[model samples]
Structures are given as C-alpha cells and as structure tokens.
Target: MTAPEDAIRARRRLTNKLIAGREAQRLRPFFAADARLIPGGGGLILGADAIVDAFAQQFHAPGFVAYVRTPETVEVDAAGETAAETGRWTGNGQSGAYMAAWRKAAGQWIIESELFVTLA
Candidate 1:
C-alpha cells in the first residue's frame, strides 16, 4: 500500500482525469458520504451526492473546461486517520488555491471537505 500522502495524490490525479473525461458519476467514490465543499465561485455544497451533482452541472455547462488540481503539499496527522491537502486548481478560465480534508475510512482515503479560493 502506498503512503497516505501518495494515496491522496493519486486520488487527486484520478479526480482530475474524471473531470476531464466528464465522468462525474464516477467521482462519488472519492468523497465521503457526508462530504462538504466550498466552491471557488462562493457557495457551500453539502453532502457527497450534492457535490457530485454540482460537478455534473459544471461538466455539462456550455464551454465548460475541466478542472485540474495539483497538490503542493499533503500532511497526514499523527494518528494517520486524517490528512490535509493544499493545492492549486485551474478550470473554466479561473485559477485558485484549494484545500481539502481527507479521512481514511476502511483503509481507503476519501475527501471529507474542500475549500477553494479564486486567486486570479
């Protein structure tokens, strides 16, 4: 098994690939059941289903561009059950810095929450 940080990086990569492919439905497994997200455009999304729905909407939007998140750092807690990922994201003609909280459940890493702030 990979280290927690590597696992999270892999997941983030997969997330970018899924978004690029417009496979929003397949993103469900990457998030926790009750995950939350604060979008770059300024709205709070609650629950994994709602988050996935939001992605679906964005993916189908006119002139949509796939978002890519490149992690700059990942830090796992001493307990090894949780991690924090800080990264930069770009898509839809916007670029931003983002942070995601990840939790390890049943030996799998899942995103618990994410916050995005548009920098430019």
Candidate 2:
C-alpha cells in the first residue's frame, strides 16, 4: 500500500518472527544498509551485507531473546517514500524505544537505518 503501512507491517513481521525464534525467515525484507545496529550510531553500514551481519549478530545474541517489541505503540511516518518508526521494546527487566528509518523501494518497505536508547 504505502510506505507507512509497509513499514508497520514489516516491523510487525520482523518482531513476530524474532519473538518466535525465527530470524531466518525475517531476513528477506531487510536491506543491506539496514544493518546500522543502532540508529544514528555513526558506524555507517553502507550495504545489505553489512546489515545482515549486524542484525544476525543481534538475532543470535544471548539477551536478544528476551527482547520483544510491544505492538501497541508502533507508529510510522511517511514522507517522500520514506517512513520513520518508533516502537516500544521490553525484556530482561528493562525497556526502551527503537527508532527505525524505512525507505520504500521495489514495492516493499526496507529498513534504511535504526537506533535504540533507554526510555525514561
């Protein structure tokens, strides 16, 4: 449909799969540059390979299993084929928010960037 819708859907799919311990199936939609690890991290991952590597690491991490994104707070911002999203993430007796930048490409929403910091 639209960038906003696509982004939200992608987010849902990604989180759902992860929460289910199914990261393999969740790898398809993420773009190469989507591997920034942390939004605005300044570590600049330039392509899909980098993105996959970064995300795969997180997906395989010990504490990563405890992380879950609460679906109720998902929001997408659509502007010029790009959408930014913020969602609630909780687990391990801790919680925070994640910000992701998405770009519409090839009729699909692909994450372009992402970052997370603790919530107050």
Candidate 3:
C-alpha cells in the first residue's frame, strides 16, 4: 500500500474505534467540512455536521450497535490526493458493502463522501 492508502486505512480504523466508543463528536476531524453520506438504508446526509449529528442519533438509539467497516480495497488516484475505499460493514445484525471517497487536505486524510448498501 502507498502512503496515502496507509493513511486512509489508519483513519478508517480510528473512525471505527470512535463509533464503537460512541464518541460521535470526535468524528468531526475524520471528515471534510462538506462531507456527504448515504446510509445503508438509502438516504442522503450532507455536510460533516449533519453526518455527525446522524451518527450521534444512531449511537444513542435503543438497541443500536456500532458499525465496523473492513476495507477490501483502497485505490488512490494518480495525484495521491484522493482515494476510494470499498469495504464490508456490519452492525446491529446487518451486514453490507460500503464505499468511501477520501481526500487529503492540509496534510490530513478525511472522508469526502460515502455510500452504503445493505445486502443482508
């Protein structure tokens, strides 16, 4: 893996840890200001603040279980400033595939967008 790939993977691991710990507020740094997310159930969430808010709600929901994403592939663009990660995610008895787009800004890798699809 290249440096950008390694960095993205590390960020993703930290993100999983934050979610597991239910520390939604700490997730802000992992995403870009205008980040977007599409949940496994198929709804669009815009902006880092909104995304974090959605996560906070899920974390506090009854019977909620934290999601963990295991990357199957990380492809970095030629410019090394962007990457796409495809992975499998599981939580709350649900499992699915997810894709995340990452961007490097100010020497840090952050998520720009993500889309998830529940398969089972």
Candidate 4:
C-alpha cells in the first residue's frame, strides 16, 4: 500500500478504536464539544476535553447508551492527513448528517472536529 493508503488505514483504525472504545465504556467525552469548552459553559471554545465530555453526556441521557449508532462509509484525502465519512446514526427515527474532521498528532490520528444533527 502507498503511504497515503497507509495513513488512511491508520486513520480509520483510530476512528474505529475511539468510537468502539467509547461504546464499550459507554462514554464519549469529546463528541459534543461546545459548552464544556467555554470557561463557564458560556461560549464557543472548542476544546478537546469539552468535546469528549459532550459525547459522554450524550451517552448518559436516557436510553442513550443503546441509541447511538455508527454505520460508516469513508473517503480519504490525497495528503493522507484529512478524510470524510458519511454514516447513518439513528435514535427516535431521527436520522441526520454526521461530519467529522481528523488530524495527525503524536504520530496518531485524532478527531479534531465533528458535528451531529438530528433530522426530522
């Protein structure tokens, strides 16, 4: 495999590992990522810790543990540093677009950004 292909593979593995690990622990601290970022849950700060905390909060909601689902289709950028995915996540029959951004840090892939919206 080419270097880009290898990077894509590594990114996918990290993504899957993070998601599945969160599922296993029933915790995703950085998934939501906003309120907790601000000093007093006040404004937009977009900190890593806050994002993970948001995800964890989602898991804590009623029936939430069993609700969050990730079914994926992945595409990678030529630089091997960026990628995009489209997936279906269902709860209350409310499906929506899931967008994610990733970055290479300390020789590993990490989620730098993401958004989840609930559709009618």
- Candidate that would win on TM-score: 1
lDDT of 4 at 80: 68
Q: Cα RMSD to native, each candidate? A: 0.6, 4.0, 1.4, 6.1
Where is model 3 more than 4 Å wrong at Cα? none
The candidates, ranked best first by lDDT, are 1, 3, 2, 4
Of the candidates numbered 2 and 4, which has the greater TM-score value? 2
Query: In terms of TM-score, how similar is model 1 to the real structure?
Result: 0.98
Task: Report the Cα lDDT for candidate 2.
Answer: 0.60
- By TM-score, the better pick of 1 and 4 is 1
Q: Each prediction's TM-score against the native?
A: 0.98, 0.63, 0.96, 0.55
Q: Please give, for residues 11-61, the per-residue lDDT of candidate 1 as tens digits.
A: 999999999999989999999999999999898999999999999998889
lDDT of 4 by residue, 1-120 (tens): 355435544554554565544553332332333222222123444765655565556556665433343537556677767655555555534666565655545555555555566664
**Is 1 or 2 the stronger prediction by TM-score?**
1
For candidate 3, what is the lDDT?
A: 0.95
Model 4: weakest 10-residue lDDT segment is: 32-41
Cα lDDT of candidate 4 equals 0.50
lDDT of 2 by residue, 12-114 (tens): 6675566457464466456534345563234555566765565676667776644666544444444557766667776545677877666768866677766
lDDT of each: 0.96, 0.60, 0.95, 0.50
